[model samples]
Target: MLSQPLSKVLGKKTADELIRQGLLTVGDLLHLLPRRYDTWGELTELAQLVEGEHATVQAQVLRSTSRRTRGGRPAALMEATVTDGASTMDIVLFGGAGLMSHYAKQLAPGTTVLLSGKVGLRRGRRQLASPRFQVLDDLSEDEREALLARPLPIYPGTDALPSWKLAIAMRTVVDQLGDEDVPEPLPAEVRAAHRLVDALTAWRWIHCPQDEEQWRAARRRLRYEEAFVLQAALARRRVEHESTHAAVAWSLPGPQSLRADLDAALPFRLTAGQVRVGEEIATALDSTVPMQRLLQGDVGSGKTLVALRAMLQVVGAGGQAALLAPTEVLAAQHRASLEHLLGPLARGGMLDGAVRATRVHLLTGSTPAPRRREVLAALAGGEPSILVGTHALLNESVQLPFLGLVVVDEQHRFGVAQRDALRERGGVTDPQALPGSQERRTPHLLVMTATPIPRTIAMTVFGDLDTAVLDETPGGRSPVATHLVPWEREPWVEGIWRRAAREVATGGRVYVVCPRIDVTDEELTDLAHGSLGVGADEPDTAGLEDLVSALGEDPSPARPLAAVTEWAERLAAEPALEGVGVGTLTGRMSPAEKTAAMEDFASGRTPVLVATTVVEVGVDVPGATMMVILDADRFGLSQLHQLRGRVGRGDRPSLCVAVAGCEVGSPAYHRLKAFAETLDGFALAEADLELRSEGNVLGAAQSGRRSDLDLLRVTRDARVIEQARGEVQAVIARDPGLEHHPDLAAAITERLDEESQAYLERA
Candidate 1:
């Protein structure tokens, strides 16, 4: 009954509106929680109004009028004169010829209403502009007081139905559905241990909390439920996935094997951590059960090398492997890195493909049609090979005949669906039936992430996969010294360019990163849409480098950021940087141009590369020791760390200069300061989680909403999430199919719908 269409529960018109806004079923409405609660029990008088202060006031409408906008647009303005017993104020509501038309008639003379909005002064006349009002018609003072006593839920509104209307509809739904009608998903024993109430009670308190504490407790209960259901589903997936049959059984041979040959051919010795991680992956490859593991290492911790070893394990078993990168640049980089590491084995040595031998192929959007067809043909054949590319690899037309292993670089950048696509490359659904079937088997999965995930996040967001951390940095890598340079200090600002010039003079390169590619209002609109939970198009590139910074709206809402073009132009004309060659790179740059700019910077043709955060990942220039990030407050904590990591790759001592425009003592200022003080990515990741929460951690590619886990915060509610996960595992262990816990099964099914469950399987 709860799964019935909204049209069956609500009216067709209301259902249409809800469905248009992506709220379809009755359950969706229950989860369409209030963004906040407005406590209007304490009302201010008209005389007490302060400019820019949000307030609620009880006033009587003396008169009302509607007029066209001054510019003579189709829009109109609805105005009203209202007064409390103490003083009078104006209510200006901007509208169309029909804007707030319904309200105009209702706001007739002598009508009493409750008005709430930011107080403003228009030509010295105190007014409430576009205030939200509630009619108090036919209501006694006692009734009005009683209505105000309950916290008013402010929901996320849509064009068809305002927040107030949503609140009304939800109240109706809650009233119709009795507390007993909504069964408790969690077992009574579990709920008692966690001190949680029933789901129905939680919904009631959430939608109609009598007080702040009530709403908080209600939210807590819902958060636990969401985390528990998701964790339970993931735990079951892990169990099933680890028990599945492998398509290719690959046991690492002795000292004379190709794996040994490849390892020996590498120029540098593997770190102890790398050797340990490699052994773990090798063991998983040897198992009949397919591998689903995460390899997390700091920037340049040899993740590619570890991934290559796993890919070779599949190759040794006469199966192909595909590596998925988030961007074309990163994909191309991976292809090049693999080819370099594999040395002669990639071409004709041991794991070679001289015609029928093992081969390595590169596939990307930029690859010519003929070359793409060639790569596709090679993958379709039975010969063992390694294919590397971006989302192009996930295209339905691309076929991997005997693909037994999959490696995803910057796995977090891709959505769960894309990973699933890659993992299902061999075209076999049931790996368990591999013993009888001639069909190719499922691939062993190895996902690599350069961004360090917090422990709490790793447990919940990627709880399904086994994790391996590459904690040690390779030898000869210099530590990057970070410093916070306030923009207000002119001398310090001038010194940055001088320092860049000095670095260039010393034969070292410099990366000068700006917040914006160009100064435009499009950024504002993009940001506005993103903040409203609308899907915003991301920067189209490979390796999902600096996406948060590229898609990032301003961290400091009150201030604008400096643009890359303007900064590059200024630097070109600066006397201090006259001798230094400066080149600019941004998302707006053509693929060819970006490549050329990177080449120039790398080869010392342009010693000073003034670019955007596009250089945040996978652009290795060991010679570039100095990085200056302008308007640094515009970036998040992890982003700052990534930008800093771009430098400090070589033996020379490196320095990162972060220029922050934020006012001292501000949150942005303190955040930048904290980033400048710490080089530890893991610590900074924890801090980042606290500051921004995990936005779109799981559904980043599938959805536009920044953070999908609205009610639960991974950082603050780690204990709750962990406890829920444990309890869920225990429950699922006793009843794998959840037959014994029908309520939990139903709830998990509802919460983790088919689409969501499919995505989580990829995770």
Candidate 2:
């Protein structure tokens, strides 16, 4: 299907060789684009070199050759220099081996050219190392000089295809088409209002702009296209999910009576925000549409109270509620705390009197196979008024009878697809005519998170969900003081501990956290040696199993701080962690195991349990008052904030010490240090977006997924993303589907096709 048509055109590789890299479609060929184009327009005057700073010099080859100096690495060194006549500079080219055929070696030099490269001193002789060089052609020196005055366009490259070659190919492709088939995606009025241009024109100007205006117009169009496509896809996915999921009819008995019952039973009064959110949830229940709301707050901001109140409304409506947490630890914690709050619920209603009205049951992986099966059976039989679990609740075999509401805690921890998956199974939207059809009705949802996200980011990530933020932490709770120590600062950390000892003397407890469990056997040995007193070997969440087993076996009065990082194995090993009552809690633990661990930690039976950064988001442990972060430099500021949040949860005072060392000046160190200073979520969020990219919005370094447009920084692109969201919604409202609009469909298809391909590859 492919042939060397280009060989006659450029005398380079024929079409046959190109096909080997999956280059078959015309679209693929165009996307080959360019890495960068050269402008021989401006030649740098060599006299301006500062001797120390690396500089970019653009000159032509006056002369060149290949040679390796006495002790230097091998190279094709081209010595070429250009002059402004007033000042002449020396230029030596190194590592030009890869450019042998690019006339770096073929000329007697004097070939007027553009040489853009990093200028450094080689043996005090100024040299340019492996920078881009282009043989000046077609234009006079003045014209070339004019071209060099502007920024250049760069594109993608592959192992075999050099960037320059890619640029040349792109120039060839654009030559044939010549920006003739540009498509306008927006309507005329919308385009006029937004100052948008056509995509093809943008692509052309991005490669070979007529001027700055053309270049900027092109960029705006392309960036908007990117933002529009992603927003539209997200919108489409959300709409599809919302339409497909089941919705429970919320016919709660009476909020006035429910409030009275809660007031009589609840130990503390609801905050203003909590009361307002309850009204919203109550209002949502009365509507035909399913409630999809996010309840956000920092640690101990009373999100659980709001959620429980909403659940009580669900039960009052004669329907069940389901709560799903990322980890069983969080799930069990939710169940226990919820049960406590709900204990004083109304008696004549579902949560009270005769038959244990609204029955509550926990369904987790560790619920014991037989018992687990029974829990599934109970849920099927509608035995539980509220069902709580990890992912097990999403199991196809697990059925929810009249599940009216769904609460997902820490929603950011889940992928959009996974959350939609749960909503699809448990939540259904019934048809217009039928109210309850056993087929379609989405459960009202209240998504809860303690991460304290900035409002801007929340809008960007959860544009579809209603948001309720609780900024005020409960009164009387002490703010934990944070400290950053370079691993070598043992004395300083000890001083903090000396202070903490006094706090401990008053019946307070301490929690030491780590980044990971032992990922290696060496880490295990180090743990055994207890060498982490100064700087922890980056905490591995893996060795948690071994550490738990070891802690249970080696119970000693010497180990005062129960490490929370090693809990995976602690529960897997024995029923009790420290004879003093220690246990582990984590994402991997089944709901039952987490329930047990949380109980142990909360009750002060297991004063310390080893765990991962999962504790970065608060899981109520009132008794714990002290926290030690091992390998403190390994955590981000946001994470450090969350980890410190675990403490200072109760009426007791709390303290946090970041034990540093290993990998000083690491990103984690910078993050933790910042965490030590700020209690503001918005500030940390801005810093996070600045210091991180999409891959690290949560964690993991992203290599492949970053988009090509650098102008669309999420930090700066907020306005554009918001505009796109609004425009897409308006357009969809007007057109329903873009079936009649070929241009919009093409743009959307390109995005979905790419996203689908990515999903397939990941799968």
Q: Over the full model, what C-alpha lDDT does candidate 2 score relative to the true structure?
A: 0.58
Q: Highest lDDT among the candidates is held by which one?
A: 1
Question: What TM-score does candidate 1 get on C-alpha atoms?
Answer: 0.73
State the lDDT at 230 in candidate 1.
69
lDDT for 709 in candidate 2 is 33
Kindly list the per-residue Cα lDDT of model 2 for residues 596-678, writing each as its tens digit.
Answer: 76667666666665665556553676777887777555444545666787788778767787876534465544556567777
Worst 10 residues of 2 by lDDT: 531-540
Residue-level lDDT of model 1, residues 1-763, one tens digit each, is 4566778888887889999988888778988999998876579977877899999999999999887776855478789999887799999887567755766888988999988888899999998888888899988888888767768899999656989889888887777777656867788888899788888889889998877788988998898888887687777776766566454667785676667778777788999999999999998888768777888888878888898888887776567788887655666677777877776778843544433235678887667889988778766655577888777787787877677788987665555666678787553433234322456567788888776543325443537667888999999999999988888899999998888888988889999887666666455442222111111123333223233443444434455666777788899899998867789876555557767888988888888888766676677888989999887776656567877888988999999999877767765776787887788777777765665556554443322236667587776777887788788889878888788888777776766655566666655
What number of backbone clashes does candidate 1 have, counting pairs of residues 3 or more apart or in separate chains? 7
Q: For residue 763, what is the lDDT in candidate 1? A: 51
How well does candidate 1 match the true structure, expressed as C-alpha RMSD? 7.4
